[model samples]
Target: MLPSLLLLFLSIPLTTVTAASAAPRCTTSTPIKTYQKCMNLPTQGASLAWTYHPHNATLDLAFSGTFISPSGWVAWGLNPDSPAMTGTRALVAFSDPSSGGLLLLPFILDPGVKLQRSPLVSRPLDLPLLSSSAMLRSDSSVRDGAGLHIFATLRLSPNRTRINHVWNHGLYVQGYSPTIHPTSPSDLASRATIDVLSKATEMGPAVPSWFRTAHGVLNAASWGFLLPVGVTVARYLRQCTSVRPTWFYGHAAVQIVGFLLGTVGFSMGIIMGRASPGVTYTLHRGLGVAAFVTGGLQAAALLFRPKTTNRYRKYWKSYHHFVGYGCVVLGVVNVFQGFEVMGLGGSYWKLGYCLALSTLIGVCVALEANAWVVFCRRAEEEKVRREGRVEEHQVVKASIGI
Candidate 1:
């Protein structure tokens, strides 16, 4: 099991690298028109293609994104000051309310949008946006039947090389107003810096990739694997006469290590939540909190454990067992939730976790069956010994009476 876990951990970096390398590159071969340079955006499986004319200081660009729903909206824009949603001159595309046809309109995202003070109504941009158009075309590459493309021409200030770009998608619009998008980590971190002259691009500020990976690994190992293993050890090992008090020590040590690791992972999670202010995983967070609290209580119970001769010892034992098992269940469930939160629901990381957990369960089942067999055999032997003693007593009594 340890070797399997190590292999899984080592493969994490490789998987991340492979996924990044596999991102589709942008190309100047759109069905509408051709472009000079192109690059893939960092999030949302989106891409940008553009032709920059330095002499005229004009840019012709196409932004492509998969539609999340039939009534959803897609947007791409330039943030003149910073790579953030606020203060962006954006082009939003959605189905027109009047004709049910594709509509592309410009809107300036100010601080009000962030505050959600009112609905997002389209208005003229303050920048020199020459012309804008949009189209919905059938795309086999996308999960949805169609893809959204926004084409536009803009005149930029002379000598301007780099620009901050922000893009996002939403699931609904109300009476010609595009509603706020989902507050997922991907949605919140959907901005980048692009250089038109050099055709260079860089992802905007977000949580460090390494930190997220470390958080997942630590939690999965501690709450997901080690805690359950410790429970199994305590359940079966203590039954053997040879391992008696040694089993208790081993169980305590394993649980302590697991709890300590889980606490660190939980702390990392809290830090991440604070870092990404708007994003929330309510269920996952709740589960983690519950598991951590239960584990902590279990640890504390050890200090106040009642002696075997005390009348309340049975109650303490019951409490310890109940809390310990509850913690294990919560931890395993939250581990799966963690995978989904990290967007690894269908990845090999999840598969590896499942395999490890399944192996542990199988081991427990085998041990339980063997224990039952051993218990029944011992009962049968004790019964036979009692019957033999009774027969010998009867024989001695008959001889004395004769």
Candidate 2:
């Protein structure tokens, strides 16, 4: 619960990070030259237009992407080796420091760039390029938001009709070097394979929505719902003399089920993380890992539980209470973090979860108040019985003395 409170405080600002509005499609007409073919790219609200000449395999292309800010940089590139970005020979465009005009330079994205060992620098691409140029445009109807267009003419190999393309935008440039781009889902998924011979385009693989939904549901049920209920049962129900060991069994069953479901959910999260490389949610991942480890420890402690009459029973109970509550707190907090990480901060799913959790907390509060009332009543009855016995004893002593 303490962890949940802390998470609530931290998550207050996450609600403001809404998704960007839709971007307009790419326009066929350009100020300089016209393209024969054009297609809207899948991610980052970007688009590509090109004209391929079959005789000499000359290709004229224009890639357009929106700027995140005034000082940001945009890039478009082709990878001859594979469909990924590691080996891509790219052309990056940014504002020139001297003239405040558009500056275009070629860069090769190597393994070092992916590993972040060194800053990205400009160099000549290995591809056969006839010419390259770039310009900034402010037309909202053609390209929504601040936009930049990269134009290039490259000579391709004979009979080459397929090409892999990558494009991305960044928020900063240190001196003349462009810094690493944002690692959000949209940014990392900005690659596609396009057929120069036709209008066909295949986007890069993305994590399925159903998989993410399942992960969120399972974790929410286990960590967010069931675990708290189990803790509540143990805390309140066990006090009833009629329930006795029944409460213990109920608590154990609920906890075991919750833990099992949480294990599956945690495994799914790990799989998703592996599937989407170069994307990281640091706080969410850390909280998840801590909760999982703490939950596992709590589960394992049941095996070494001390006997009821044992001298170590009190210490064992203390350990169990501390760890159990800690796990519950971490689980609840991580569930909220999961919502933010999945970009469902303002979705109906979060609202439903919040309503259910609030209901549970309300139930716990009512039960706590009732338990206090029962305790006070019993204590008062015990005191009255003691006073009655004392008065009767005094009456008997007085009669015997007379």
Candidate 3:
């Protein structure tokens, strides 16, 4: 009976050991109470100072601090002899701006557990940071043991305004001390930031990005379609001697095409800008309006009777030039603006378009100016020849006594 009892006891010990080995080292995390004591071990050999990242970033303050290392590396003073070192609870502190209190964010270390949060639409976040990402901040990482020891640098985002709205924010962590559910582990970290800025609920620009992209493109396209019509009119004004039927046909065809295209493009741009309100979107709107008004006026000019005199034609030419150039300029400006809002990156598109336009404009202006100069020179020469012919005829008649 005594041998049987001894064998049962020995078997019990083996089963317990197996169960313990299979179980995780850490799984549950406890929150740090403000009243809880933070233990600091005597540093004999600590890892380099544990890097400190602030919860809220302030001007004139550095985002840094010290921490304990599990290895007792030299960075922080290590005392392997301390019970806290073995137990894993030490200190996580931030400096209090007033009176220099060591504000501690404490945690009982755990591993692989996470605390998730949904963004609050109505409540204001309690943070001094100007980053919108603070909405997703969690205290899961308050505990440790995921083998990630990062020197986090939490700072305010530089983006201030979106659709005249201000965004406030701070750091978000996963597996943070679960404020809502306390039994979760502590090894979670959020790589994606939440919010730094937001637009007002009533703003037109409060629409989503995909919607804005579609709309803005349409507006821009509408503006562009009108361009070819103006270009044709400009060419005719410069080259046509008589306003022939073909000239009017060419103008009418181009106008029809331009208006159709511009309308589609304009509608799209409005939709897109309303969807994504930003600096680029503002420009897109302004340029779109300008294109529409100028194009409308140019088309309307057809209703007015132009004078028959050559000089009056020149006068009409000035109006045509103004409207044509205005439409062209607006179309071109919006194209670049669209590309910018799309975040197409770098000066790649801008540079290419600039070089092409500059070359084309330069060639046209030079040729037009040369043509005018030659025409004036020819007129002067012809005037001199006609006068000389009259003078010669008069002299010949006098000598013949006729």
Candidate 3 per-residue lDDT, tens place, 1-402, comes to 989966875676577566544533321122211211111111111111111222432221111112222211101011112211121222233223343332334333222212223421122223332321100013222222212111212233344221111111122222222122211111010001112222122223222223344444444444544465447455644454666656666766766677667777677666544433222335766877887888788778867738766467877778977887888778777777766655543556556655656665676677678768878988999999999999999999999998
Best by lDDT: 1
Between candidates 2 and 3, the one scoring higher on lDDT is 2
Cα lDDT tens digits, model 1, 125-148, are 998899989877565332343677
Task: Give residue 93's lDDT in candidate 2 (0 to 100).
Answer: 82
Clash count for candidate 1 is 0
TM-score for each predicted model, relative to the true structure: 0.56, 0.56, 0.43
Please give the TM-score that candidate 3 achieves against the real structure. Answer: 0.43
Give lDDT tens digits, candidate 2, residues 225-259.
Answer: 99999999999999999999999999999999999
